[model samples]
Target: MSVVNNLVDIRALAALVPDGAKLVVAKDESGVAMAATRELVRRGVRNLHLVTVPVSGLQADVLIGAGCVATVESSGITLSEFGTGPCFTRAIKAGSIRMKDATCPAIYAGLQAAQKGLPFMPLRGIIGSDLLKHRDDWRVIDNPFGTDDKIVAIAAIGPDVALFHAPLADRFGNVFIGRQRELMLLAHASRKTLVTVEQVVEGNLLDDDARSGATIPALYIEAIAHAPKGMWPLGYGDAYPIDAAWMRAYVQMARTAEGFESVVAQWLAGDGALKPLVGAGLGELAGAAA
Candidate 1:
């Protein structure tokens, strides 16, 4: 199928994400859109309701530290091996952003409910958990067809936009998610889906038999940008490993507000800001993510 060439620059992709929008992001392993996220910070986007599919890492910490988010709904937010997400921790302690606690299954169920156009999705794992008590939206309901069986009804979660990074996108706009199925669901449950990729290939991904199974159709994608290393500092599938040195640096610098500001300033000043696209044409058009 033909498409309108959803290819855009990182800045344009960030422009599509506005203030006060409900934005959902993927987990680190699912291809985090760090580069695009930096652009959002550069534009000074504000009041975003950020939802992390299950959980998140540096991206969440960065956005929270930047004051771009007003609320965050996620199972948890941590830097994983790098330790606590200092900015996210600070935000919660200061009550700067509303935090809605959730479980991974509950989050998936909520999105699934939204995908199916349902008001709520019944889940069992969260029924006896503290998250259910903390989340009033999650209700304990009696099983309709069983006796005395109770379940937690998770409210549907649909975002204004779903943003992520991926390995590749063809000139036709199809993205190669390649086993990260949650991205498909994220796209399905969101009003729009934006993608940044490590490279732009010459042909449609869907037309290739081996890659077709893991590709997301262009119809579900609003726009895509060619951004090599878009997921830098974090790994992208099996293509690369997390940049351990950078992770350590971020963890140390993000400990204080002042240090964090310096980090952002340096990043925006081109330490990590996007440079010009390299090469040209379908066979060679690829550039650093940011």
Candidate 2:
């Protein structure tokens, strides 16, 4: 999988995601995730799983209403608090799609087990929690070498697709994530991957700085979209600032399923509803239209 440098279009990137596929989104407030989610819903994808480090701003509300079975890595937040009143929240409480903390070795081992094509991995934690109640997928087996009572075996999560946004990419799809390594592991573990980059540069930007080229090479990349300001709402460090007003409006509009669909439609129609701020590279398009 040496797909480090290549450039492709958004449509090409979106095409890789099939209907009814289970998608895992690396949680970020970035417009890239927002746009990717909108596209997934627009394409009739029903099972969407969102994975984020214990923090908000991934727009859980939108995914839940779209019928996506959302999952979040536990970060000291109680199930009751996390499950609140959102649609996906309720679904989680109702047991439609399971939720657990990957920060724990048990959960991380489970994902690793799946990535390695193993059936399960032995875990010492989660002995008395309700996580064991749903043991249909997990099994408690005795440690052959030890006198311990039992260890929980967690299953792997190999998602159907993964989408992420990077700071720079070449026309051939070589991505440079800069400092935001955000969920780079889960993105690589997925069967297919889509990347939306700020600008498509030529040659190897990684040659100048190896620290910047932390993620997958171009071979693993399915497609690269030249989407400037795609990381809106999530600041790209020195690249740009978060758009607070736009993020607030986006969250409100995507609160309903219908509104979510409409937003995607507007985006596809080139109405510039989700377009980046002026002077951020998209200003030329705005000016040409005017």
Candidate 3:
């Protein structure tokens, strides 16, 4: 089958994200796609139902602070080593956004249900915790197969769009997510998947022996944007290390309302320099195995 070349400029990529869209993003420390995120903020995409698979860090926090997100769903939002996510906390405290607190496994199950086109997914965890108390969609049921065991059923999480960064992609649009398997679930579960890649390769990734298993085929992807150092300030599973000092400074700068605004100002300034300049070595991982 012929594949449409979905590769687009970063701004054009941002334009594809509709306002009030239900969006799912990759987890913290892996495939965060900060460059695409800043473009979304610059375009003022609003009222998003942002779902973070398992956990989040800078991506969720900055979006919330920029007034782009109206609701957030995730296990937790933190800056990891930098500390808590200040903007996410502030938005929750000020009642500016709706919050759906979920556990990691439950979030996975919800997306898995969507991936499999199932009404709900039966998960083993969160049955005895307070996490279930806040979620009306989750139900604890006795095993119907004659066992005395109980199971928790979580409703499917089907997002309007799924977004993430990947180490590399091919001309055919197949993305190399490596061992970050959650990205596969996200792409399958969402109605559309937008991707950013460090570089674009020549042949079909599925035909490459090393990348076939780690690849999310072109058919599932809606658009692709080229963005080197796209996961700056966050680790990319050894593509490059996280920028620790920059992240620490960000933590301090984002601690207050005014400070956080300044952080955005500096990043979104200079027309388009918000994209980080670090990590020029991503090309080294272009054709290599994960």
Off by over 4 Å in 3: 1-3, 270-290
lDDT of 2 by residue, 1-290 (tens): 34443455666666677655655554453324555555655565555455443333434555555565445444323223223334444456667655654444554565567567787777777777775674465678888887967877777766677677777776545677665664465455678778887777766655656644574566667777787767654566677766555554445445444444444444445424453333333434345433
Question: Once all C-alphas are superposed, what RMSD does model 3 give against the true structure?
Answer: 7.6
Better of 1 and 3 by TM-score: 1
Which runs of model 2 end up more than 4 angstroms from their true locations?
1-6, 29-32, 49-60, 68-107, 249-290
In model 1, residue pairs whose N, Cα or C atoms come closer than 3 Å (at least 3 residues apart or on different chains), thus clashing, are 228-289
Candidate with best TM-score = 1
Ranking by lDDT: 1, 3, 2
lDDT (C-alpha, whole model) for all candidates: 0.86, 0.57, 0.85
Steric collisions counted per model: 1, 17, 0
State the lDDT of candidate 3 residue by residue for 69-166, as single tens digits: 99899999998778999899889999999999998888899999999999899988676798888888899988788588899989999999999998
Q: TM-scores of all models?
A: 0.91, 0.69, 0.90
Quick one: how many clashes does candidate 2 have? 17
Comparing candidate 2 with candidate 3, which one achieves the higher lDDT?
Answer: 3
lDDT of 1 by residue, 1-290 (tens): 67567899999999999899999999988889999999999999999999999999999999999999999999899999899999999999999999998889889998999999999999886655677667877999998989989878888998999999988899887899888889989988998999999988887788899999889888889999988888877876678888777788778878888667666765665545322222222222112222
Model 1 error, position 164 (Å):
0.4
